[model samples]
Target chain A: DVKVTQSSRYLVKRTGEKVFLECVQDMDHENMFWYRQDPGLGLRLIYFSYDVKMKEKGDIPEGYSVSREKKERFSLILESASTNQTSMYLCASSGRGLLDTEAFFGQGTRLTVV
Target chain B: TQLLEQSPQFLSIQEGENLTVYCNSSSVFSSLQWYRQEPGEGPVLLVTVVTGGEVKKLKRLTFQFGDARKDSSLHITAAQPGDTGLYLCAGHSSGTYKYIFGTGTRLKVLA
Candidate 1:
């Protein structure tokens, strides 16, 4: 089965700390994405990568960054964690095709910044 | 600004009841996907609709894509307690090619 594995299921970070959320996919999909989900806000895209060493900002990418140095690995970074950045972060992977393919998501990381 | 909007943010119904959730957007989508997320878990793909005015059924659940490809709906027949979860709709943006999710509909099926 295709799997997207998140490095952490839960995390606690101090304010102003640099945070890293890692994800790995077994499917070797060309597309990977990071999204933060909040109540009533659903899942908002933060960043996505179409290939290794390529990243694109999403709608809400102000405080977040992404790294895709390898084919199966994608990482989300918070430059300086803040209380407002506390949210459930999810990682997803999809095969090359966007129209017919489905994106498989990781279990998610619930981050709490204090 | 939300590109996709889902109506009835929350729904609660007894077992065996039917419910329909709507996802609306003004921007056209090449394809739309529906996902279900349980507590403490990420969303799981339930179905993907690519053609306009298309309908797909998965046992007790039915999905419909709008004729304009700008909207979609999910209908559940005889909902069960096991079907309780947060339902989300996602569609790729025209220029960005990134999927944007709707506000979501939280459904609680009481037995």
Candidate 2:
């Protein structure tokens, strides 16, 4: 089975603090994504990377940035955490192919900004 | 803008009941996918429908794609506690790489 691993399951950080959420995929997927899940808004993509050092802005990318230094690892960075930034963060990976190919996801990271 | 809208934002029913969740869009898509997400975990792919007017069944769950490629639906039979979760639909335009997700449907099944 393909696996996507997130670095942290739960995290708490103060406002104005810099935060990093890490993700790694073992399947050598060419696409990586970061999404924030909220109660009614569902999952909104923050950023996505199709290749090393390449990133694309998703629908909601104002408060987030991403890094894909390695093929298997993609990182989401919060320049300065704020209360509104607290949410369940999800990481997913998928092989390069047609758009419908299912994307495998990590367990998820719940971040709380105080 | 490409958008997928899911209907019946919330649903609660007793065990053994049948229910259907709908995902609709105004724009055409190449394919659509259904996913179920538990409270603390990321969403898992339930099924993917690519062909127009195609229907796929996974045990008690039935998924169908619209002929216009602009809509889809998921029907669940014999609802159980194990089936309770948030259901999401995602789709991509004909040549796009990113998948746009729906608003989601939260279902609760009582025993």
Candidate 3:
């Protein structure tokens, strides 16, 4: 069975504090993505990495950054957490082909920046 | 930016009712996928439709992709309370791994 594990299921931080959400996929897929999901907004991509150390900004990457030091691990960073940044963050991985687009996702990390 | 929109943002019905959720977009997609997400969990891929005007059925759930590849729909027959979830559609444009989810439809089937 394929698996994508998120470091935390829930986190609460104060404004201006740095935050990290970690994810690891045992599937070893080349494509990993970070997304923020809110009610009615669905899942909006924040960043995606196709290879280790290679990352691309997604549509909503303004307030977030990502790190991919290893192929199986992807981390999402919030330089300074803010109230508006509170949302459910999700990690996903997919194979490296156009047609191999089936993404397996982690359970998700719900973050609250107060 | 490619955008996918789903209609009937919220729906509530009793068990055994049939319903359909629509996902529409101006941007054409090479393939489309449907996902179901329960509360507090990540969305899971239910099905992927690649061909134009293609139809796929999973149990009582029916999925359809438009011939233009710009839209899709999911129909559930005799929905049970277990069918309650947030349904999302993802569109992957020509030769890209940039598939994005639709606005989403929240469905509630009461028993």
Candidate 4:
């Protein structure tokens, strides 16, 4: 079975603090993504990495960034955490091809910025 | 504008009741997927519909993709308590790796 492990389930941080949410997948997939889910906004993509050291900005990438140093790990970085950034962060991984491939998600990390 | 939108943002039904949730979009998609998410957990893929007008079944759940590939629906024959969760629809555009998720429908089933 494919497993995507998130480093943290809940986090509380002060304003202007830099936050790091880590994710690791054992499926050896090439496509990894970071998404923030809000109550009525649903899941909005923050960033996506198609290969190691490659990243692309998604819809709501204003205050977030991501790092993909290795094939199995992807990290979401909050440069300067703000109260508005408080939301559930999700990490997902999928195969290289888009067709017939389903993205698997890890247990989400709920961040609360005060 | 929201690329994908789901109707009936919240639904509560008795056990053994049948229900259907709709996900609609104006833009065409290469593929659409349905997911169920429990509280404090990430969403899990329930079904993926690729071809237009295609239907797939998983136990009591049935998923259908619209003929234009811009809409989809999920119908539960007889919902159980275990079926309570947030249902989300995600669409992937052609030549892109990113998926645009729908607003989501929160379903609650009571026994």
- Give lDDT per model, in order: 0.91, 0.92, 0.91, 0.93
Q: What share of the true interface contacts does each candidate keep?
A: 0.64, 0.69, 0.64, 0.67
lDDT of 2 at B108: 99
Q: What is the C-alpha RMSD of each candidate to the true structure, in Å?
A: 1.7, 1.2, 1.2, 1.4
On DockQ, the leading prediction is 2
For candidate 2, the per-residue lDDT at B13 reads 97
Residue A32 error, candidate 2, Å = 0.7
Candidate 1 residue runs with Cα over 4 Å from true position: A98-100, B93-96
Winner on DockQ (2 vs 4): 2
On TM-score, the stronger of 2 and 3 is 2
Instruction: Report the C-alpha displacement of residue A82, candidate 3, in angstroms.
Output: 1.3
lDDT of 3 by residue, A1-114 (tens): 679999999999999999999999998799999999987567888999999999999988987889999999999999989999999999999887656857888999999999
Query: Cα deviation of B52 in candidate 3 (Å)?
Result: 1.0
lDDT of 4 at A48: 96
lDDT of 3 at B24: 98
Tens-place lDDT per residue, model 1, A51-108, is 9999998878998888999999999999999999999999999877534357789999
Interface RMSD of each: 2.0, 1.4, 1.5, 1.4
Q: What is the C-alpha local distance difference test score of candidate 2?
A: 0.92
In order of appearance, the predictions have TM-scores of 0.94, 0.96, 0.96, 0.95
True lDDT of residue A69, candidate 3:
98
